[model samples]
Target chain A: MRAAGGDGHPGPVIELNGLTKRHGGKVAVDDVSFTASPGRVTGFLGPNGAGKSSTLRVLLGLDVPDAGTALVGGRPYRKLRNPLRTVGSLLDGGGAHGSRSGRAHLTWLAVSNGIPRSRVEEVLDLVGLADVAGRRVSTYSLGTGRRLGLAAALLGDPEVLVLDEPVNGLDPEGIRWIRRFLRAYAAEGRTVLLSSHLMGETAGTADDLVVIDAGRVVARGTVPEVVGGHASLEDAFFALTEERGR
Target chain B: MSAVAAEWRKLLSLPSALVAIGLTLVAMPALGTSTARRLAAQLDAGGDGVLGTVTTLTVGFELVPFAVLGPVVLGVVIIGSEYTRGSKDSGGGRQITTSLTAVPGRGRLLLAKAVVLAGVSAALAVVVIPATIWLAQTALGEHGHTWDALGPRVAGAVVYWMLMPLIALAVTVVTRSGIVPMVFFVVNSSFVSVTHLLTRVTPLAAYLPDMAGTRMFTAQGPVHGGLVMLAWTAGLLAVAALVFTRRDA
Candidate 1:
């Protein structure tokens, strides 16, 4: 429903420069740096416990980085005049209240951000939830909930998308839909930073790949370059993570 | 302004806010009239309107517990619902995450919440008190009315209504749950004034928010009740603001 770069703001260049985050005595994302630029899908691949979630949280300004900056569009997320309009994000299961209808939840976000109600309806329709938008979110299935989260991220028609494990629980059809969606979104010259453990999905959907293990980015290159001499992306991913485990 | 509207809408979304408000508006007048009528004979004969028929008739009925509890409940709900965890094992903690992402500025978000809370509490008092005064006067012989005492008392009711919720809201902001504030304050208002009992041992207890707030209406206090309420409200808010701004969402 959104025109390509509809707001005319160039898709943001997301940068995590020497980013380091620690929880108590343990470090989560340690001195990691990367860039996700416009007009391409940058897949952040990492195994669980590899700190992909923490990095994404920092990137979205959900968690404060202990020692570095996570910048979008040349500024920290909190400094952006309208962050949601610049970067659409999906965090975990999304933060919809159980008591609120899907429409009400989106309505409040729209109100908070000054987005029109018509936009909320359009996002609902975009996510295939317009018919059930009146139902309390407590009734939605897991996949529907994810779609609702995606709808919120898109509410502002942002130039950049930062999503965490977006296809974690989707049906195969839903996963394929998301893959197609991300590809098309990046093709429209908007930045897409997606993290997933599913190598197959990332290999098929992403143009560039950054793989992390144990809170560190160990490899970065195009799909074929990372997969060099390996039969498939999956084999390369395991070999890389296994080599890092040593 | 948008944040304020959003906060108000968020408060309205909760069934608790609407139920608490509706019940208080209807219940206070009904209870005030019935109680005033029941004590009419003793109230009239007992020293010929000694404590002022209006005060004696309605103070016990409309002044504490029920009168203030609903507003107090709503105050807690405004912030408490955000801390409520959802069914998907998604904790209430994420709400702060979502809100911060939406608003970003910690100080602005908290300010919006405070303004909305005050506005809603004041609005509730406006709807409820005039009707309550009318019902009480009708039961006490319908001899027209006296604005002399009511001028201050209604002002006091407005202060009381606004203060109770603000107090509850500040605590909810700290504890991140309405349950504690709702239970403690509702009980403190209705059953036993913990602050009142503590006052016997230490008059300092009288300076606690509720007791000081009661002074607005009763004009009895160990200190200037309004100022005490102001100090406590301002102090609690300061602490909440500090924590909210410093902590990672």
Candidate 2:
């Protein structure tokens, strides 16, 4: 049996307690909450407009939540000095400008946070973009852009990784690499919170699940725990999201 | 300090910004000489020996309508360039998001930008002031002001060109596009007749940033021209700070 109280767990490194966000008259996230613990891959699954991006935005301090708190490392992300060195994040589309060269884009981000210039090259190599680093981002293919984004995310070598749809444009090889890399990253006692609708794909990687729909967490637990006697992870995901929480 | 340093690096790296700097440096001297000769001809026709006539340092104020164009573009380029593309939220392309995420302190980030703008403006002035003086003296020869007489004009010219664009920068913040301010500055600064007309209706229009900035060189300018320029800049910057902090990136 699993251990009970006094499990000595450090609790979650990423916490969203009673997070609520509204867009004018519309409610984006209605008091939804969850935690991403260390040394495990926590999958954030949802349908389109399910408030996945909104939650990530507030968590990263890109957008302020109307009510509730989103904290990283037990402190608001805004308070950290050179936050990239603490929580590396990869938002959708990599937040890149087409006119800026891939290397130059990373250079400014590195410079802004006072990260070493040499780290720029290191990340370029890490993301397998070393040869094309000098080319303008406009010419980059979607997969290439994703690799560049990943490179930027790894530039600070942060302990916690927050990624949104990171597997979107990757090929099978790229997806497998990410799966292996994220798993290995979690194995190193770091926190990995990945949001994607790919249930079966995430099944082999994530240690826990956070299924959200209609601006609330409908189901969240270990792989099978959320699956709960269902035929497969996807079946469980559909039940939790489409069926409006059984 | 790091944020400020990084902003400087970003300022230098921008290609459009480099073009603005190059244009201002080249055009100031190229146009200043021709302008001095024409103004010297005007002074002869007007029959006056005004101590600090616009022709005293032609490049400093006489042909300002055109000279101001380059620096004005440079100002607009500094802030508007960011909004040209990728400010959209569809992808992670909004530079503001990346910038604010890294800096977090909205006020400090904009202040760093302002400082970079000021530093670049001053550097350009360092080059433009001397070159324009030498060129104007050579072109206007006997018609030009002497060294002692030309001192304040040189100081005035630098401060004027450097501070003028900050007004445009603040406007760009509100418009969120450089195009609006760029067009407005180019058209407004190109022709003085419109300003003259506006000043007739409201004499205090003389205290506008452009006019107040010009006073740094003109004989008829008010005693508090610098303070007037400072007030406008401070007011606009306060607006930018308010809007930038309260809004969602």
Candidate 3:
């Protein structure tokens, strides 16, 4: 899936073109293309087995691609001058050092990228983690861990944000906060690409959508455009997958 | 400055790094005192080595902790913790590579890790060295033997300890686990007893990392034997660095 909103280049801020990845004999993500642009929240929609994480991994340069390319700002993510500043990403909350304090985790990231230490404080406050930032991550709840992950991504004040299942285990309040936060993030001329299995949570927040099924792009367009003739986002998604399977 | 600072922060913050250093500090003095007394007793009986009984004991037990999983475990943890956080492919190596991709000079991070590991290992050795010397002298009753005479060999011992961690870190980077390399280190590297025996039959045993590294503890040496050991340590570390830079992290 591609993130939209390139800086007037007519190209996307994030792009995946004919991307194909296979693990041994089994194909994980087949040839697919999508773009996420700035000024919008582009939801990367797919079912349980739909290569959502795999595609994200490829875009983040975590997984090697057998075919095609994954790019940010018209260049590969790995080719960026300062990746943390150009693009912010939160892949897995489990990535944090459990024994290290949340503040330390962000501090290392900041220092690694030449960002100021104070940015760590700003992000911690932004994520509502300033109070408990000194505590070890091993003590954090799943929700709190996700927030710390978010803080890390925002440390660079990046131009583009990529989040995978950001609200997977958030409470209702947390979920609402993320929805508003992401929309406001994109509204400030930044790009946001989010992945989720829940169709409802995404329907309200996403302006554009890319639906994938079994490693293929089943549909892609504005929210209304994709669901134009369907009853709801779920109905539209089901219809698209059903038609693709047929 | 930032790259070094970041690497240093990572080393200091890691719990295992602290534990490893703590253990080395506590163990060295205890080991030195016990061995000093043990050696004095053995010498009084029939120990026959020109370098003295203290030297013999030091050579005999210097590599034990690493052989038993101390340094090897620390090495594996440095790389393995990244894998435990997520997919091994995207953990520490990927994170570093991604950072390097942005900077376009990936070698610095590798250098940074090596520098930090080597720095901490050496600092720990410095602390242990004096304590070991003091305890050994006290337990042996002032024989007027100075550590200054053992300077070259002591330097080599500290370097050997530092190099072991780097080699282990490289193995963990490629393998992405704390267990596999530790098992390899134990089953393969520490099978030195068998190699020691093989030396009587085969000349090739002299070049192995285990045999060659042991020569670093020699009390006073300007011989070809110590140089051969230095070469072995250099060889292993070079191979690790080459593999680390070329592979897809």
Candidate 4:
């Protein structure tokens, strides 16, 4: 049931223009630019240390880009009022404190954005973590913690979803569940931008693809367009990245 | 206001924060009682010198400085918990990412946390100061002072307790980890007060935050001491806000 935000209104747009970030003397993201539009699952693919996390971090206002802009609905994340209600993001273990119960973790997040506490239970049930929501997150398995993180991301029922490595830790069922959930979510006219190194999964689930290597976008287009002349998306990924490497 | 409410909920939900409060509640009074009992025994033996001159009010006031350890821990944990990493199996993530995304505005997030820290520490002081005073007074028996006699000193202790946590908050923010500030503050509060020792080496040490803060309750110039400690807190928090807002999370 795509009841939440399924009114056919286009969700907020995520745009990064000439974005550059540096850590110490090294560049993490270099002149990166792309758009993740409503009604699309844009799979942000990259090798490890390819600046996917850095770009997402800047977009979420967790980091300051040395130059350029990362914006949601034409405003910087830091400038958005009640950002969570507009953009729900999952970055690194869902940003949860280990000592807190999953419900408590989501409760504070909801309270921060003035979201009704009832939504906490709804998201918990939606993510299938209702029975163990009261358990400390430290006790959760890797896959369970990922679900908890996903639960938090959906807590605010935002217009845009930004997730880094959303399926890093999940069983086969979980993988299938998220694949279906994200498709339904985007079908409701919401934006989804997820970063992962999983090429096969990206090929199967994502409508659009943006690939980065060494802090630069090497390719961008629909899944089939980027996979041009290649046997598969995985083959296309290696071809593009290896060529850049040389 | 919603941000503040979120911070309050966050601090309360942390098991470590709760444990710190519980331990402070039980430990502060116990420590006060034992100290008061020892001082009373020393006086009963007809001891001459500083021991003989110690009044019940003095006994109660002496315990106030040590009461700071609780607030220090509370402040440290409030911010420290944000930086604590989950297990490796859990993607080794920290809560700071979630916090930043929810609040977005760095200044607003830091302000919310400071407000919650101040509120909790002040509330803790209200419960703790009186409990410690009452227990210490009881242990002093015939020489015990009434609550009325300790009025302003109790107020000073509350302010002192409140400010100490803010100082801890600023330091923890700058350090971004609980280890350094936790070790330094806990050691200085309990075992050997490096700040206290520095006072003997140089009079300027009296102007230090902890020493000057203790003067709020123990010395003759309560207002002066409170102001000095407030200045230190304000200065450090300014630096913390700058560092926090300008840095990458």
Best by DockQ: 4
DockQ of each: 0.47, 0.49, 0.31, 0.82
Cα RMSD for predicted model 3 = 4.2
The number of the candidate with the highest TM-score is: 4
- Give candidate 2's error at residue B227 in angstroms: 0.8
Candidate 4 Cα RMSD (Å): 3.9
Model 4 per-residue lDDT tens digits across residues B47-92: 5354655655777677667767888888999899989989998988
Query: What are the RMSD figures for all models against the true structure?
Result: 4.5, 3.5, 4.2, 3.9
Classified by CAPRI criteria, candidate 2 counts as medium
Worst 10 residues of 1 chain A by lDDT: A1-10
The stretch of ten residues in a row with the least summed lDDT in candidate 4 chain B is: B47-56
Chain B alone, model 1: TM-score? 0.88
Model 2, B43-124: lDDT tens digits are: 6677455445334644445655456566667667767765655423234455665676678887888888888888778788
Candidate 1 total steric clashes: 0
Ranking of predictions according to DockQ: 4, 2, 1, 3
Better of 2 and 3 by TM-score: 2
Score each candidate by Cα lDDT. Answer: 0.79, 0.78, 0.72, 0.88
Q: What would the per-residue lDDT of candidate 3 be over residues B72-177, giving only the tens digit for each residue?
A: 5566666666555533322221234333332334466667766777777667766676567667766765332566655666666665666667667777777756
Residue B204 in model 1: lDDT? 83
Query: What would you estimate as the lDDT of candidate 2?
Result: 0.78
Decide which is better by DockQ, 3 or 4: 4
Candidate 3 displacement at residue A232 in angstroms: 0.9
